[model samples]
Target chain A: MRDILTIEAVEKKATRDGFGQGFHEVAQSNSDVVGLCADLVGSLKMQAFIKEFPERFFQVGIAEANMMGIAAGLAIGGKIPYACTFANFATGRVYDQIRQSIAYSHKNVKICASHAGVTLGEDGATHQILEDIGLMKMLPGFTVINPCDAQQTREAAIAIADHDGPCYLRFGRPGWPMFTETGSFKIGKAIQFSEGSDVSIFATGHLMWHAVEASKKLVQEGITVDLYNFHTIKPLDEEAILESIAKTGCVVTAEEHQRNGGLGDSVAQTIIRHNPVPMEYVAVNDSFGESGKPAQLLTKYGLGIDDVYAAAKRALTRK
Target chain B: MADIAELKRIASQVRRDIIRQVHAVSSGHPGGSLGCTDFMVALYFAVMNHQQSFNMDGANEDVFFLSNGHISPLWYSVLARSGYFPVKELSTFRKLDSRLQGHPATHEGLPGVRVASGSLGQGISVAIGVALSKKLKGDTQTVFVLTGDGELQEGQIWEAALYAPHNKVDNLVVTVDWNGQQIDGANDDVLSLGDLEAKWIAFGWDVMHMNGNDMEEVVNVLNEAKDKTGNGKPICILMKTEMGMGVDFMTGTHAWHGKAPNDELAEKALGQLEETLGDY
Candidate 1:
């Protein structure tokens, strides 16, 4: 396995920041691209876009449903609208608005959600939305993408602008490590960051860094493991996962979302359909997230690096 | 151009189509559809400068959205009669594999519908988006949307109501079918939407009220709405209408809000709504 632990003290930046940068850049070139933020200008990192193009940016004052409806309507007028808000409000609160107006209508709206999962620390379960993936991916034709780091998220946001359809781009609050290379994000393809043999550890969103760290620890312990970034949860890269797990004979899925309807569940379904393997999940169990620091929350909710290592070990044992 | 008499005749035919369409399916909302018949017919045939051949972008021409989409029967009838589709297709409403869904939708390539609107409180925002688009493109064309008084109870409606006028989405007109009836009894019984006109006025809108059932009054208000556009404020027409206007037994109550009439009721309703323009 490749040594991905060299950058132990790397500069940290929130994935939402990447979204802001990419959205602003995309809006500059594509005159038809517009943005609507539901009163989370600062948290969602949309100040730059709003600053650059005041005419195109809409401040929809804490009303996520209205923002979604407006985005759907904007799609009809030949404008690609990006609706930004917290994952909780973007999915759970305004789900029906997205379903009827955006998803069912097949509006060309980009639902850019920030502060997803337990990483949205100190806000408790109400703000930390662990179930947005389930809500979004279940909708027909909704392309669900959860980019791992800052560079990948920037590329993901810019990429969705070119693709035509309703999409849910989920990002987190924590200033994660910029581990992946710039412009490395692909829509439906998995990135094999490191190769191994004993087990294939698939991680997504903020969990990718932790999984990488866990792999380093496992490698020191003489356990060779394969690491794959399962960022785009829907339209999942099943071929890559099946091929990797076929070689490894076991798999461990990790995400900052819930154990039931997130990356873990997605991998399980794919593997069950194509190549059944002994799989273990390193994700938040059935309980809701609580107020704490990102690291504390990750460890408390069983999504820390230790959890990934433990889950990988369990998958290897099971196999 | 449709004369007052011709517009009234078209409305009567639309009412007939609504009844027949709902009765054929035995499912779908007919009360609201019947109530908003005149306004829809007036807007499409006379008021809005829209094309008979539907275009999704709606560039250079005015566009319409049915926010209270339970009244899909009304919109489908108006679009068909106005040449958006085959008038014969009205018979396939609510049937399996029909483009005329239970609610107005853009999917299935329904020509007239720009967005899906069965779930209430969404149409106004979409209209605001289209209006904003026109503003961005410097198109100067207007966008129109219709909502129910009951739909205003939805919180999203309040959010959109606050959004449009605040943003100066001036080239847009919203008409609330203040029929006073919802699926659950009257608006008073279901939930009192007290002082609706006052509410819109407070929300920074150009508010106007008209008797929606009166074809002449509806036509006059709609024409006035066009003149009122581009005045730096969103237009709201608080249109008062009866639940099932022309049908005797179905009127004055919310029981028939979603219920389709039986064979006898359909016959009686169709008898009252004279097919001035031949029915589908």
Candidate 2:
């Protein structure tokens, strides 16, 4: 396992790039894997697959609902369709289409959403979706995976294709650290980055990078921080959560999503059910993100490295 | 192949099933179900080359999707009478733990139903998807979908309307049940669907027209619509029908769009139609 304190992240790539590459790789292996885009082929990095197999690619043209239904239809027809769009359009805009056609029907469609959370940047609140985790996870039989970094996102794209049934794979826009190694990705399995008996830091998506930074900073300051990457938010690694909290005695959840229904809530629900622990949530506190640089948005929305650090301190104090 | 008379007899039995199913629950959509009976019966019994065994993939056989899923009573009757499920299951319509849900769902393991639908304006896109899958697999079978005239009000329907022709999805045939009545009132009185024929033609579909209630016309137009496929354009049939076609009191108004007929009313409705097939 790579140490969070000294792990080098020399390359920075957007998680969507990993999805595009992974999707292309999966298409190469699985003929049943078809690509459908809501006019965001280039943005979603679906071009490579489209170029390789134009016959299998479908350009749904700005219609997210139709794209969702079509994906469900394709699934029904024995095809594994990756319905690609932004997080905002993928979940909130087409919830009903997904509910009836995909989730309720139990169709094997992969809803791959790019540009998730505040990291979507300048497009602002309209494009950045903070409640997508809640929207997707609430659906029965939905596998919601919010992979951290490019390598994990790529593996997720390929992994979900083999896993039968409906899935919501969320990735982001900005070029974040490509630190997580390949072949380490698994759905519903958490990656424990460091072992400590102080505050356990559970993080997902873009905020996982910040949590790593926060953990390293806390470790330098004589605080033992247990860090785990919660890639799959729906079939949550509850055993890992309970085990970690049992050791650390307190917990802190970090994510670039709403405080109400995102990673924090999932962790809280697990804790409340199992062994209750004093927990702090590092997330957007029920406010829509505004136009700003990706880094500025994170800091402004209380999802920065400092936010995780502060939240860890609060959880530790309560413990 | 069953002649028009036999098809009409099956349709009469289906209408009786629809009325009885809705009347037993007293909380299902009878108006549209009653209205679309002839079309459903003709398609299942006469038009589409489908298997009663019901595989979800529907490979090598024509697959049907009921987009306007509120008419579950109609679809349940057609599926049952055609031997997709036991005809006795019709009595359990809208009851607890029934395969025949208030809306047609695949969740309960309903044999004929491939997709869950009660939310309108989604079936055409789904049909197009299945059609695309058929084309990819080199299967020449057609994909059929039925939508309500009022369902066109949903933006996703138009999105599919734009998509099918642009992609040359020719193996798909979508029929709009232009029943003229919705839950509130007539479509024109509610939200006018002006020039539906012109609209589909402009959307680049091979358009056809038929009276959905007339078994012969329904069978012929559906076959015509199927034959029109694979020529590089999707087909559309603008089917005109009365909302409550068989039951006198249910017809001509949208009042029975979702409301079930009372015991006396159901008996009266059953009195008009001869149970050509034995009642379930």
Candidate 3:
């Protein structure tokens, strides 16, 4: 297994690229695996799958709701379908399609959502949907995942195919630092990058890299904080969360999403029910994002390493 | 065999079940349920060659989706009579802790229901998805979906319509129950779906129209649709049906769209249709 960091060396690669690659790889091994895109072949990085398996790739053309229906139909005939589109269009735009056709029916379909959160820079508020996680996670029998990096996204693509029922795999457009090694991915398992009993930071997607950076800075200051990468948001590893909280007594959750229903809210709900712990949420504060570079938006919206650092400090004070 | 007579007998039995089920619950749509009885009976009994038992995967068997799921009384009746589940369960429609809810849902782990579809205009999409899946699996078995004419106003139906023909989903046979009435009033009165057949044909579907209440035509047209499959295009059959059939008081009116027949009205309705298949 190649290390995950080496896979990340190819800079400027969108997380969607990982999905496209994994899709092509799965198609080669399992002829039953097929790809569908809603006129976003180029945007969702599904061109590679389309080019490789022209017979298996379907271009539904600018209709997300229809694409979802088509994908569900494909699943009924025993084909594993990965429906690709932007995060906003995939979840919010066609939520009813997913709910009735896929989730309600328990269809084995993968909803691969690209350009998730504010990282889809320059598209502005209309394209930037910070509530997709909430929309998808709330559905019964729906598994929600936000891979930390490109390599993890690729593994998630293959892993989700093997699992039955509906799933929403969210990834971002902007490429960040890749920290995990290739082929070392596990679903629904939180990876602890750093360990400390003082405060635990649970983060996902692009925010995972930011949490890592903050951990390094905090380590220098002699504050040993436990850092966990929560790639799978739904079917969350509750045991891991409670174990960490039992040790830390205080927790900080981070994601590039709205504070209301994203990873922060999920963690808060779980912590309150299981373990009563002091926590701080590092997310886009009940607001929308505008057109800007991905890095600038992260900083401007208080989702950068600085925010994670501040949140860690706040969580420690609560402890 | 006289297809119309056989279908009418089956439909009469289904109608009795529909009224009995709704009357037992005191809530459920009987207007559309009764209206589409002839269509459902002809399709299940004479049209599709499905297995005796229901299978979710449906690998080698023909599949059917009730897109206008508000007509679950009719569907549940036909499925039970067709041996998908126990006929005794028919009395549990829309009751507390029953497998049958107001809208059809798979949450109860019902054998025949593949998807939950009370929210209008979603079943056609799911049926299309299942048809696509069947093609991918190399299964030649066809998928049939039934929707209401009023339900066509939903934008998602058009979205799925555009997708089906573009992808050459030839295994799908979509039927629109043109009852001409919705919950409020006539479909034209609510939101005019001008020239529905023309719209489907223009969307690249192989369009056909038939009198849905006539069981012989329903079966023959459906057979024609099955034979027309694998021709690189999806098939759509526009079925012109009465809002209520068999029951004299309910027929030819939208007033019974969802109104359950009371003890007096139920007696009147049941008098027109004899219980040939035995009431649940």
Candidate 4:
């Protein structure tokens, strides 16, 4: 885990900012990259892209399901449409549209959802969506991706344009420090940050930094750890997961999502298939989050670094 | 203008096809399919400017989307009889491994269906998006969408209803099959769709009403809707059609909305509508 720790943050930025930058830059080369928003343009940081490509930007005005249908239509017309909305409205509200029009029909649509999970902060359960990953991953032929930070989110948002199918690209609201440099984002490959022979720490989305911090604290306590970032959640990097589990024998999965059907369950499914491993999850238990500071909510909902550290210790005992 | 007699001939054939196809499967929507036959026949054979050869993007041509997709028998019949595919393929309706899915899906590679539409209220937004695409591309062709009045109860229909006119999607036309019957009962008994034309006008649409069961009227009003396009408003036609227009037993009720006919009833329904074009 020390290799990822050594890759220090250059600056702090939100994953949503990365998405905006990536989409704006991608629109320059691929003229087919049409953008759509349902009255959350500023919240999704799509203003700049809209200004540059005015004709391609469609403001659907508080109608998320219609926005999804419009994007599906555009995709059918040989245009790559990115339907941007809050994570809750993007997945839960328009699931049937996405299922019938995009996923089942296999249209080329990018469902770019921002301000996902509890880190959306102070918006309460209405705005914060902790179950989006679960909702999207269940659909067949959908590539579900939740990037860790700004640089990775930018890479993922741009990379999905070349993929000719429906995808759900998830990002977050709060700005945090960047940990890794960009490039080398394969669709279903896991990145091994650092190698250790004890308990493996698997993390995704904004809580990735928490897992890194957990490894740092665990190193000082002489519990060597292996760390990985599972960004592409649907195509769950099963080979890398089994390889990591082969060495570590146990796991601790951290994500800013519900415990039942988030990244943790994916890892648990993979482990039980290839190699059985005792696993502990650092995720929101079966409950909704209330309005609070992002950091406070992280700590309160058992997604803090200390929680990861404790989960790893617990997993080691099972091993 | 098309030969009204020939259009009526094709409409009769489409009605026969709808009855036979649904009867073959024993589990498809026959009421809406039979009701909307004249409108679809008039549109494909007389109204729209489209090509016989199908492509996915549908660049530089008028496009049609079936928002209420339970009437797959009607769509498949019209699509086949109009040369989008073989008329013989209509016999495969709703069968396993058939391109003609219970709902229209593009993934099945079926011609004339650009988007899937069985889930109600979703197709109008697709039509609007294609209209917007044509506007962006400077393509002059228009887009048409057909929806059921009962399907208007879905909240997404209103969402798409609010979007098309607000964005000035002028190069589009939509027709709602105001048959006043759903799978449950009469539309009034199920849930009243109060003041539907006023609802479309209130939503900023250039609203028109017509008797969709009349082939000549269906052709004329759809073309009139076409002429009204690009005048800075989308058009919505609240077409007044019977629940099952030509079938003696099925007409004026929702009993045959999704239920297929038994063998005896199929022969009886087929007897009412004479086949002007050869059956598949």
Largest DockQ belongs to which candidate? 2
lDDT at residue A70 of model 4 (Cα atoms): 93
Q: lDDT for each of the candidates?
A: 0.90, 0.93, 0.86, 0.90
lDDT of 3 by residue, B11-111 (tens): 88999999998887677899999988988898888888898877777878888988888999999999888888899999888888998878888888888
> Once superposed on the true structure, which residue ranges of model 2 sit more than 4 Å away at CA?
none
**Tens-digit lDDT string for candidate 2 (B202-251):** 99999989988888888888888888888999999999999889888888
Question: TM-score for all predictions?
Answer: 0.98, 0.99, 0.96, 0.98
lDDT of 3 by residue, A1-319 (tens): 2322222334546677787788777778888888888888887777777787887887878888878877887786678889998999999998888888789878889999999899899999999999999999999989999998878888898888888888899998987666676766778888777678888999999998888788777878888777788999998988889999999999999999999889989999999998989999999988999999999999999999999999999989987
Quote the true-contact fraction of every model. 0.81, 0.89, 0.72, 0.72
Please, what are the lDDT tens digits per residue for candidate 1 over residues B142-260?
89999999999999899999999889999999999998989878889989999998899999999998999988889899889989998999999999999998889888789899999
Q: Could you tell me the interface RMSD of model 2?
A: 0.4
Candidate 1 lDDT tens digits, A128-187: 999999889999999999998888899999999999898999999988887787767889
Off by over 4 Å in 4: none
Best by lDDT: 2
CAPRI-style class, candidate 3: medium
Judged by DockQ relative to the true structure, which candidate is superior, 1 or 3? 1
Residue B28 error, candidate 2, Å: 0.9
